[model samples]
Target: MTTTHDEDAHLASLGYTSDFKRDMSFWGNFSLGFTYLSPVVGVYSLFAFAVATGGPASIWAVVIAALGQLLVALVFGEVVSQYPVSGGIYPWTRRLWGRRWAWMAGWIYMIALLVTIASVSYGAGPFVAMLIGIEPSTAVTVACAVGLIVLVTFLNLGGTNLLAKLAFFGFAAELVGALAVGGWLLLTQRHHGLSAIFDTAGTEGNGSYLPAFLTAALLGVYLYYGFEACGDVAEEVKDPRRQIPRSMRMTIYIGGFASFFITLALLLAVPDFGKVVSGEDADPVTTILQNAFGPVGFRVVLAIVLISFFSCALSLQAAASRLIYSYARDRMMPGWHALSRFSPRRAVPPNALLLAAVVPAVIVLGSIVSENALTKIVSFAALGIYLGFMMVVLAALRARIKGWRPSGPFTLGTWGLPVTLVALTYQVLAAANMSWPRTPDAPWYDNWIVLLSAGIVITIGLVYMLVARPHERHDAPHGDAVASTLDPDSGRATEPARVG
Candidate 1:
């Protein structure tokens, strides 16, 4: 059990054989998390959204969001240690609750990731325009986003090796890029002082600080995710049970801190708060970076930002494809036979990859129809992903309440139940905050967009679950034959424990 092949035996215990080539190193696994949690991409896209909604006072939302997501990530790390499977959330939920719960979780998570790809790419447009010295017109931005989606689709077809390389490159580029540019801004700029972030300038009529804060916190709730990227590709990462849990934690710790720093620095460096909240400079990253770096330095930063955007899409698509492959392999998704087709030689799921590309490409068309497309797309994604997340959290809490104990190497041990309760509470509050309508006089479609869209996604999943009533496999293990265990030394749980 103390060998390199130990992971294979552990995976087989849960009823699957390895189909992926284990080529990702600990760095590669870590890089996957970092790239997926790309700081540059998150702050660049949503910083404006936060400022407009909550002003400088909203800067603290990152810390609050990180604290909550850290709780979520800790639970995820513990689960992943025991159930180190591809399609991380889906399989983990299946092992914790049942096949039905797993199917719905996968459904929600898959759709979230798909919309995330579109949103992140849509966000990338302005940065790319800056690098190439263009105005970042709506058409140019949409085209850029669509083009990158196609590029990542082709790149994914090359297999995991290229993704690993690209992930590492992205990790380096973003870190150096953020620190170099962020560091320069803080050093060269005049003082806005610590009190500036506490200033609620434009939040005059936006209700109490609580509501405005919640809306602004979407930046954090939205930004702090994608750390689970490592677990989704667990089959490909070496020593997954150990490496993945560690990667998940570090992804949140380092990535969260970096994003907060870059955000705070940019906010403090703002020359005119009024221009940022209500004018063309709303996104601020464009103006702030250009102001700090000049046109030449701005392009350099934009280049790094572009690299991050590319890797984020690449990692996101890679994660989504694996989820499809995982579902297909279990005979759950439509056309499972064809989607399950994997080239043992190339170690890739071409059909799943194709589906992943086509869906996002179609989803990105939202950018074409809506003027405020990126915000709506992001809000939609945040809602979907948070719902998907809370399901797993609820499952874990239920299992614990029913007397289930930790069997994972990364168990929270004595603190497990308490942490689970708090985490579930945070997720519920966060999800509600994102779904609430903020506009008082807006059109019906705009006001209820988040709720309507989220409902549609959930309805589709529930209908499928009811119609199919799909089980994990034809000969799914039953009772004692498929029991859970935790080796005192290894702490790996193979199957869901039945509760009386």
Candidate 2:
């Protein structure tokens, strides 16, 4: 139960380089947990699908979405805790399967982050215009997106400690905002009762209950997107194998329940779907609050929404920068050796941070140039995430079915087998459904975006395979099992070895 446990010897046996500092504690991991299950991004996702689905049933859709992601998270928690390496899913698969599969996973994950950075920056547009008192237009939106990238980059260069601190603040603000909105609705809608939520009667106009349910459920996956933030900081976390599993599971459950309750509350409180959906600017949460509690309520909700975006901006910067640093160290990215350099003063990846900022900033600018262009970009972003998830889930399932047991601080038990399978099933269905073109008249439709993005990632991975394969170190020992235990006294680093 202690945070600092012996993992050094175990990791050393597995050939984990000790050069990278392992300084973060369990609290740091918990903060990462909160960051991974972001509320603001959750809100943004809900709105996107809500608009598409054109019904109040978006609330239930979120619940179903969260459930699908939970399946993925379950497998992620089991596998990651077993490896607890900075390689994240890629290394985990490599350990389970081989290098080619690892490369594929890594390529998909890297592209996923790239698209995510673009999407987030794009999302920052509306909030930026709102913050600066400008008319809401595509041009302003893109500018805001660019600004977000820059701000996040600056924040990330400050280091792991700074990332943890920012995550805490962001988590707090998001929780408060979400709860405030949910609470206001719950308090006022006492008479409508909880049954209104579990009932299928309110799902008006969205043909076929299952598809309607699936539409809203897809948005809940957004809440689970960033939990891998913990995996990104694997070197820093205390007893990463143990703490990571704990954090991942905790984040999914808390985030899932919170989103479900909040969505239900909103659905129950909604008085007029027409007014709320009439304009792109319409926010159901804001509308409900304003109607019930007047202008003060409206302002409160707006302020919270803005704060959520700010937190997301900060966390996204940290995750993306670390990803850049990881890729550079692996020599998959150009100027790898130089980009992997850490700040002497702050012990952070300054160059990597800067690069992360630049890409996202460009995305923001693009969003500003074209109204909701970032939104379109993010649909591709979701595609990237699902693509990566598909690989990881398959890998995990392969391991399970083949009786390939990898030891770690955590295990998903019998449940993991079925969950992993289900996760894969859900991923394919969700991705296919979500990627369909809104208009059949549009050439190429939505399928091309997913195809092109996947093609680009695979091509880059193939190039890496040909050019950047690291020579195997014959002396490096590979352990079949990973052992990790926290240092109880110091709570700073894990004990060298206990399990492997």
- Top candidate when judged by TM-score against the true structure: 1
In terms of lDDT, model 1 sits at 0.81
Clashes of 2: 26
TM-score of 1: 0.92
Prediction-by-prediction clash tally: 0, 26
**Model 1: which ten-residue window has the lowest total lDDT?**
474-483
Stretches of candidate 2 off by over 4 Å are: 1-5, 51-54, 189-195, 198-207, 274-283, 292-297, 368-376, 446-448, 463-500
Candidate 2 residues 236-309, lDDT tens each? Answer: 77778888877766767777777776676777676654555555546655455668767655556666666666
lDDT of 1 by residue, 149-211 (tens): 999988888878888888888898888888887788889864598899898766657457777
Clashing pairs in 1: none
Root-mean-square deviation of Cα positions for candidate 1 versus the true structure, in angstroms: 3.9
Per-model CA lDDT versus the true structure: 0.81, 0.64
